[model samples]
Target: MVVFFFVVGLEVRQEFAHGALRDSSRARLAAIAGVAGVAVPALVYVLVVGASGGEGLRGWGAVVGTDTAFMLGALAIVGPRLSGQLRVFLLTLTVVDDFLAVSIIGVFYSDEIRPVPLLVALGCLVALWLVGRSRQWSAAPYVGIVIVLWLATLSSGIHASLTGMIAGLLIPAYPTQRHKVVAARQLFRDFWQSPSASSARAVGRGLSKGVSVNERLHEYLRLPTALLVVPIFALANAGVDLGGGVVADSLGSPVTWGLIAGLVLGKLLGIGIATLLAVRMGAGRLPEGVGMGSVFGGAALSGIGFTVSLLVISLAFDSSSDLGRQATLGVLVAMVLATVLGWSIFKVAARRWGEETADLPMTLDSPVDPEVDHIRGPEDARLTLVEFVDFECEYCAHATGSWEDLHGRFGDDLRYVVRHLPHHPHGPLAARAAEAAAKQGMFWPWLDFVFTRQHALEREDLIGYAAELGLDVEAFIEDLDSDEVAARVQRDIASAEASGAKMTPTFFVDGCRMVGSYDARPLTEMLESSRRGGRTQAAKA
Candidate 1:
């Protein structure tokens, strides 16, 4: 169990450090839902079981967790529309959900708590934290200290599995600095130039040091933990005998029904209601490819609590007891029910939504102007969006919010072409700086950085960004003022003039020009229209 949770801990660290949870705005909805999912289920358990004023009231923790592994597997069974951002949202939610469950166990389920060993465990954690923040890269010392912490925690009467969570949190997540990476690359280049065994070893060591310890541990432990540790725990714990009168006894138990109501009804109401209120109140918007019905479906699916619930069950009731058997039975039954209910709801809702939106109007026009050069998209894309943008244009800067969404949502289906107008005083310099960054395969990032800090696109700012991106600072400065790059910017301006775009942030969907700044929804609709039109053409052919 400790080993299995250790792997789960590593994943949690990974997400917070570099994955979807890194963006608070994106993960906010999920975090809310997870908390609600836990809180509301416990409330429902209390309502249903607390009414009896018996041992059934002890089972509140049984419904506070979602088995992420089971939920993701069930999502796969349901189909692809359940993927993308919604999947990310759910994954993050489960991470939070499971963390809460573990914490609950540590706080509420432990026996014979000892302050001294617990404090020692905490001190070990602090040591790990300090080592993580320091320049130390070796894993041996961290491992030894963590083992001692685990033993100390075990002696302290805390759930030993918590050591995994603590250790995982302390693992370093960020990569080495850009300068270090660049220096390593330089060393490797030098080594290649000279071709010695020692230089090759140095290069290898440098390269290895560039990656974070968290990522390194994750890569090593993920497969073993999943295949061996988790399965072993499941095999050991999931063997509840349902023979003879055990089923009947379980059915008759209030504890069983409490678990059921909490898992099935409580989760559904909690997640669904909370999500609707959040979205309505502007606390959060639904993830992409998800609607109200999908939310309800996901809420239903969130009831599929297995592994974590089992741990909670063990803590809540002795395994040899009738209450424990009943709770386990309820968990198994709830998982099946949740899977079926959620799957059915999602499929019907997705189908209805798809049919409703199937006839979205076609906004297709001619192919993009091949003469204009700056582009980002797949070569064989059927649709293109061209932007005639000025670096200092406020509208253009605001318009990036929509463009970013379009780029992410449409990906390779819609090609994005950038053309410079250079209308503002600093526009020419910004455009030239972008062109120079393009020489170093960093045009898009440079463009994003420029817009993000549009007011700070001075020469020094451009030079600073160049240095930040590990570009040849001298070459970038030279190119920023060169006649060739200047001509390129002028040519794009001329092309925009030929297209009759007088504004700063003019856009063309293919060749059907749309002037001024727009929102993501309309742009999304246009892209969808263009895509459908292409498919229609193919069908005719």
Candidate 2:
């Protein structure tokens, strides 16, 4: 449970950093809906269980959230194709839901607090925060601190569940810096030339440092927790003997019925109505390719909670008690009921409203426009290659040579388009500079120059480049900081996110994305093959 919760924390933090939480409107929408989702269900749980005046009211936390892994897995297993945007929207929602769920457990379900050990744990978390902020690459101090922290938390009368989550939350998560990747590439080149053990070790260290600790831990821990820890824990703890009269008793018990109603009905109505109200009230809009029917179906799906629900059950009541046994039966029944309800809702919505789309959307959302977009070749070129790039991305810099090679091979036949997806810290600054240069008819030249000198992308350095290129430095600086330039760059960034181009250097050839290597040879071969198949920009247009 600790490991699983730790992975959950990592996922929520990732979403907060890069996914839904990054956008203000989306965050607002998610916040409103998340609060409603939890609040409405809690109300229902309290009402149902409270009226009976039973101890079952203690388990209200169980109804407030959907198990993210279970929910996402079920969504994938079921239909709803081309749901990339929906997935992002739901991921953000779950981040809020799960964060609330964790807080509830920590505050409501904990044992008596031990201030001494709790303070010690708090100090350890502060140390972890400092380590995370210091940007240390070595994992030794982190591992040591976390081990001590976990032990302290266990001794602090806090539930063992929160230690991992708190630790995961304290770890900083962010996009990979381009300079680190560039440095790693240099190390790899060195190892390629002089294949020594020392060189190999250097390459390994570089690669490790190129990625954030949060990502590394998530990549390593997610599978182990999912495949091993969760299954083992569920089997050992989640088992309830339904063969006896327990099912009948649960059916009659307010405890069982309260949980059932709260999850199945409350989650559905809460999320669905809250989402509709929020959108209608102009709080936020739904993700693209998602409609109300799909939202309703997904809301129904959210009721199938598992991990946290089970954890809450254990914390709220003893398994040996009648209330606990009844609650377990309710949860098991709710999973089946929610799944069936969600599946039925999806089928009905698909057939009645025609809102079904079960595959990922294949085409880019934003099409290339020659008038506004940078274009190197003729407008009537036979082939079109559109790339979304982060200016400070190392891979984008590495891929700059491919354009020349491709153009040299098929100069008149290909027109290349560049769009911004400035996901790094300095990417927006760099993109604005590029646009500033573009206003002076030097977009391509600036691209080439900056790709070579990626290390020097400060505002002053960009102005220096404009002067070196014999442009009006004053005008370039003015335009570089202009709102219009910022808006223009933001459009490309938004387009990149919506277009399903996840990485920098993503290439779309003749309106189709290239899935494999973006190297010159691979792209040339792809282009040649497309031509043989009678596919081209003009042909498609």
Candidate 3:
């Protein structure tokens, strides 16, 4: 729990400081998607169990989560042929999803507790905060403190593992000024040097700095709480003894069926329906080189329930050994089904679609043409505004809001574009989902949806949103498998880098770079200046 919570804190900090949570809309969508995923699944589980007069209905909460490492690892094995955008999309989706899952456990799964232990826990939290703020102690002391907190939470009826997250949040990932200075110097040197030499130097320096800064910070920030701790918990708690009497009981349990059905069926239905509605309403469009087959293939893949679901199961039936096992079974079944179904769909689509034509000769190293107006003012009012953003990048999402506000204020004056810059291993799939939304002309709507629910962006929830958007379910699935869109997304990422866009929400104001979110006052000022310049040129002509 201590490790996990620390990771969570780190991830959260990263999100706020550098990741997708910075984009208000992205964050909001994640939160919403997370909630929808969790709520719908839990509801389904409860309804099924309740209708069947099953006593294990309470275990419905356990069947949530995306199992980031497993899912991403599988996708990774598929190689860059899969859309990088999709990977980022999945990451943001799951982060929000995990956040929501943990919140649910904290709120709904906690036991009747005494105030004394709770106060002690609070004290521990304060101490952890002090450690983070002060950067006084080495990694060992923080680790020890986290263990103590984990015990307290466990004894207090709160999940003990949650302490891992708490402790993680408290510990500093980049605890000292020296670390930051060194990192900055290294980054500067790398920028001026060859990639190979820079990378080698970075590796050596990073190690010698000691303290496992990223890992400790991840633990301090509770990112590991979600990624590592949650996964471990899932594996431990989810491995139900199938021979137990609970297996028989689960056969008749509505919660079990509901969780299974929700994850396997409902996710597809919700995402599919929402996608269709979005397309029909003309809010988004399919990726330029994608079709219905890909959508469905991706949606099916979205059902792989691992981490959050297991956590929910643990929480909902913390005491009911029988019910917990049943929930675990349901999760296991759903996960397998989702994975197989999704993979099968992807394979078939890839076969049918064959390889996408790489006719657009573009790569990350391409230069931006000054004459092209790629950002702001739609060529046609109905044109979309496509963006390639990084989730672990605050600036990317922050820029997203500016575009969104512009669209809202201008109405038909603009549309949206989307791409992905995972920046780190954990951000790709969520970004893909956003781009995938483009396939059905519901990209903006879906983006809005997920951003509003940023806090809940879970893996299952992302799939659920895809289904809810009712994209050409099959095409959406295929798109996830299709390398064409991913390549396009990659091209954009490269373009952004070439253009020197280093933050979230980097804007191309009619193809010229516009950095950061600006209020109307500054925006108008710049606009007027540009207008004046245009007039002066015309007059001279």
Best candidate, TM-score? 2
Mind giving the per-residue lDDT tens digits that candidate 1 earns over 353-405? Answer: 65111111222222355444667787568787877788787666233477778
What is the clash count of model 1? 0
Candidate 3 per-residue lDDT, tens place, 282-374, comes to 544433233445545444555666666776676667524766777778778887787777666667767887632211112223433324313
Candidate 2 wrongly placed segments (more than 4 Å):
351-354, 357-361, 364-384, 389-450, 453-504, 513-541
**In model 1, what are the clashing residue pairs, if there are any?**
none
Candidate 1 regions with alpha-carbon error over 4 angstroms:
175-177, 184-204, 355-541
> What is the alpha-carbon RMSD of candidate 1 to the true structure?
10.7
Candidate 1 accuracy as TM-score: 0.69
lDDT values of the candidates? 0.76, 0.81, 0.57
Question: lDDT value for candidate 1?
Answer: 0.76
Top candidate (lDDT): 2
TM-score, per-candidate, Cα-based: 0.69, 0.80, 0.54
lDDT of 2 by residue, 1-541 (tens): 7778778778777777776687788898888878888888889889998977857789898898787777777777664754556777777887788778877888899999999999999899899999999998866787788888888888998876677787887777888776788799899999999999999999999998988888888898889998998778667657887767888899899889988999999999999999999999999978667878878778887888777788898889976577888887888788888888877887887899987863234466678888788887999988888888877777762345778888899989988889988877888899999999999999998888788887777878878899998888889999998999999998887776666677788877777766657778878877886777645442222
Ranking by TM-score: 2, 1, 3
Q: What is the C-alpha RMSD of each candidate to the true structure, in Å?
A: 10.7, 5.2, 19.1
